[model samples]
Target: MAFSTIKDSITFHPLGDAAIVIQAGADIREEIHERVKQLFTCIEQHPFDGFVEAVQAFTNVTVFYEPYTVHQAAHLQTHNLSPYEWVKGYIEGLLEEKWQGGGQVKRRIVDIPVCYGGALGPDLEEVARINGLTSEEVVRIHTKGTYLVYMIGFAPGFPFLGGLTEKIAAPRRETPRMSIPKGSVGIAGKQTGVYPISTPGGWQLIGQTPLPLFRPNENVPSLLRAGDEVRFVQMSEKEFFSMKEAER
Candidate 1:
């Protein structure tokens, strides 16, 4: 679907009974992502009486709320609407209002050093074969492009990044690995992402970074978040190990 069409008529749908989804676009584009982040920021800054939290996704924002509090809101009693409807109306109002401080979001740039090929990137050869390119070319192309974090999902601090060039695009493996090491950078279709924690995945592994994406003890647990830009810098095995040891 065209982004302009979706932008003209933003959809509002209920997620079960406690949450509502505000769809900003039909496809994943930076403009659509900007709209989603803008709405997310607006909602986070100006929450309703029952608002809990809002999660930003590639094309929409899912808002969670306390249903009982919404139902008990004295102001909403006159409308005789359900909690979802009340929240929807509130968000619709927000859409019409000028965003106070959401004109632009501060995008953070994070450079992650990666060791490509060898034991760290077991599927590197496979990815090169699939794309009809040499392993060195794959690394060159992958590192040259900057990626945008559309959202964090599947695992804690796992960023679903966009901006992967079609030249090195590779499909997911037919069978997913039982456990992919944390910080493994992989490509699936047109997207690339890092496994923040050790987990099962099927993306074509091309490299691995030594950085810790998830920090359980920190106030902000995720090293990366939605709207951040990631740059991959190639490193040698010796450097990777040195950095890994330094991290330890």
Candidate 2:
């Protein structure tokens, strides 16, 4: 059954009792991702009454809210509208307004430092062989491209980036590793990402970063967000060690 449409480009459907999913478009294109991000930002800035958080994926944004507070809102109570229905209407209305305003969301560029090859990148040679290129060439191609932050998932502060160069594209390992160190940079298929914290993964290990992707004490835990631009800056082993020491 058809639920509803927004801007003739997206489909909105109920996710659960406390959340709704706005499916904007198919594919991981920047235009659609930006729209989803903008809609999420708009709702965050102008939350109804019980906004919680938003989770952005490849082409959808999941909005979570407190139904109790929403039902208690004076305007909603007076209108005798169900909380879910009111939220759905409000989001659809926002989309219409944004379309009329010619909405355009700006992307943020984030630079990350990486120490590639050698011990830092154990699978560097394998990645190069799989792509039919030298280790140096692989590094050049990987670093030169500007990647988009498609979504942040798997773990807190972990960013799933897209737009990797074809020359450096490599599939994930057949057998997943038991433990991957934190700040590990990896490539799987056409996407590249960093391991925010130490955990198991199938992505081919390429390098390691000194950046703290997740810090609970900080106001903002995640270093990267959806719709952000990511660039990999090559660093030396000495530089990586120095940076790590400095952070300590």
Candidate 3:
């Protein structure tokens, strides 16, 4: 299904009985991300009878709803289409309207403090060695650019970011680590992200953050959300320890 001619060509795929994926595009690009976020906002602001929530990703939004609620909805009874078909039509109609109405939304920028290299970053030297860059050069280049919070997936609060400078890009480690500490920052290819919880991962560890990214006890567990921007602020090991001590 075509949402608009202005870069967003949407395609729908059924995700079981109660959900569907609205794919705006196939590639990883900023415009596509923005469009995805806008669609998310539109759905949140003006949802249908059974609308529950939308999960964001690279170029898609997975919308979840109650099938029973939709099946019994009075206004929707006139439509002969099944719940899935009606929901898809609802999204497509909104997309068409948003395109004609010039839909635009603001995003938030978040600052992340990181202490690059050293023991905190076990593989920092390896990344530099592979890229033919000094550790300091790698740090400078990594922190210089602003990254987009493309989505929150993989683990709980793990943010899939874009806009990592190609110069510092490095492949994931050949062998995965047993247990990566929470708040560890790493880069895999052109993607840079932090470990929100202890998990096995292979991204080249560059540093660790003291800030908590996931809090299960909170109403909204994830520290960051889709459509937010992130800037990494470099700090010294001394400062890291100081911050940790203060948090304790």
Candidate 4:
């Protein structure tokens, strides 16, 4: 594996046609999340010729690009270069220059409203019972903690969040739910995530947000982006219904 540091971030050279993984840290942490966000922003603002898209994951950002376009570009074609090598070199050079001057990118924190422990949150009681905490206590801890958007995966626009309080951590259900409704808030092991679409899942359901997670018709399909901060604000069932109706 080839590794190089750019600014405070690190890039990894892995074999892949569609993308190369640029890792910011060895493990998942808030700082790493911020760094990854910064790098993503940097690339987006000053994208290379063939850049297509980026996939943000736990500790890395995978950059996807068109190899043919990159290979044929005037600035990149001089050397008989492999697509992977050319892209890697270009990113490394860009990072070294970008970080020479001192400045940091700021990430935004988003708050989502959730209604817990009712018909909306059918599994909330189960989760609370498993953790030996009262239903109210579980909601308190979940809301009190600040979560980081580590990645957007599992399904389109589905945000895999980190930094759940251990007081509410629980394993996935023995049998996965046949179909989980969209916007379902769930916890599995130490990770917490929101389901972006109606799909089958095994995560312990606790609550759900009325907001739409993925809307393909909009300019940005996903409501949440990687490297963003998320906080779940508790709402009453009435409030949830109000918000849902407002969206209609």
Candidate 5:
């Protein structure tokens, strides 16, 4: 949805006993996404008494909290509303306080080297054929496009990327594979992503990247996060293996 709609359009609903979801707007537009980031950051900056964590998605922020503590918080005594109402009001206040265009959401540009076609991208030819283009042209278009990390879900560190070129878009495989190797890039519908770990999936295979997407031991476990910009670059198989060895 547009920025003007944000004033009275936000919907605050409870996600269960201990969580609340604040929906800013609709659609997958950058404006709504940036507002999501802005609201996420606002909550992070001034965490309430029982606030546990907040998960930011394309258009909403799910806030987890300790219900007991939140209900008993001395600061919330002024509001006679229930815990859900109290939290909603608090977030609404924050929106009014800090929602001044939100500015440009800070984003990190991550470069991903992908070895496309051949065994790595078995569906590359099919995807190209569906779009009436050669595999080389498909790779060129995919590499030229800039993607946004809308959210990380499905698997640990598996980024749900936006901004894939519509030219090479294809449907998911009718039958999903039991084991898709980690770093395998795929496209389904208008979205694209990489498999952070071996798992069952049906997105049409496009390429593979050797970079580790998740590192639990590190301070930031996921290589990419929501709002980050991703640019995929084509690489030769020889360079891909060489870089893999260098990383190891």
Candidate 6:
């Protein structure tokens, strides 16, 4: 089916029976991400009869709704439309209204302290070699850039961060690690992320953060969220150990 485009380069597509994806653009950019977040806020504030929740990503927002609630809505009864159609129209209306009141939400700045190289970052040197850089230069490049949390997926609190400069960009390991330590900072291609929990992964290990990215005990388990700004602060091995010990 041909996709429909709206103002601000937005597009809509139905997802199965109960969800619809609203895309801002074809590429990943900060402006496109801002549009996605704006749409997310619009849907959250002005929900239709069957609205469930809106999930944000790099260039789109996936809105989930309860089909039954939509189908039974008195206003929708006269339209003789399916749930998907009703929801699509509703979102279209929102888009036409310029994503009402979704103006520039304040972004949170999150600082992640890391100890780069040595035991914690086993693949640090490998990454440096791949990029024709020294381990110190790689660390300097990484800590200097500010990253954006484009989305939270793969694992709980695992933030897919953007804004990795080409200077330090490295490919994933040829072989996946059997088990990665929790809070390990790794780079896969143009992206960088921290392992929220111990799991198998292929990203080149570059550092380890002493802070816990995932905390199940908290009401909001994930330490980070989409739209947050991230900055990496370099710490010494001694400081890393001290912080880790304090967490325990």
Clashes of each: 0, 0, 0, 0, 0, 0
Model 3 weakest 10-residue run by lDDT: 1-10
Candidate 3: RMSD to truth: 2.4
- Show where candidate 6 strays beyond 4 Å: 1-8, 98-105
Q: Give per-residue CA lDDT, model 4, range 119-187, as digits (tens).
A: 778889998999899999999999999887888888989988888988899998999999998889999
lDDT of 4: 0.82
lDDT of 2 by residue, 1-248 (tens): 12234467777788789988988888788877776776677677677788788888889889998999888873676898877788889887765564322355577899999999888888899999998899999899888989999888998899989899788989999999999999999999999999999999999999999988888788988989888899999999999999999987
Q: Model 5, residue 211: displacement in angstroms?
A: 0.8
Consecutive 10-residue window with the lowest summed lDDT within model 5: 1-10
Q: List the residue pairs that clash in candidate 1.
A: none
Off by over 4 Å in 2: 1-6, 74-81, 98-104
- Tell me the tens digit of each residue's lDDT in model 5 across 116-190: 989988889989999999999999999999999988888999998999878988999999999898889999988
Off by over 4 Å in 3: 1-3, 6-8, 74-79, 98-104
Cα TM-score of candidate 3: 0.92
TM-score of each: 0.93, 0.91, 0.92, 0.89, 0.93, 0.92
In lDDT terms, how accurate is model 3?
Answer: 0.87
lDDT per residue, candidate 1, 119-176, as tens digits?
9999988888988999999999999999999999999999999999999999999999
Ranked by lDDT, the better of candidates 1 and 2 is: 1
Candidate 6 lDDT, tens digit per residue, 1-248?
11234364777788988899987888888877877777787788898887888998888899999998989983667888888888888778766664443355689999999999999999999999988999999999999999999999998899999999989888888899999999999999999999999999999999999999999999999999999999999999999999999998
- State, as a TM-score between 0 and 1, how close model 2 is to the true structure: 0.91
Q: In candidate 4, which residue pairs get closer than 3 Å at backbone N, Cα or C atoms, i.e. clash?
A: none
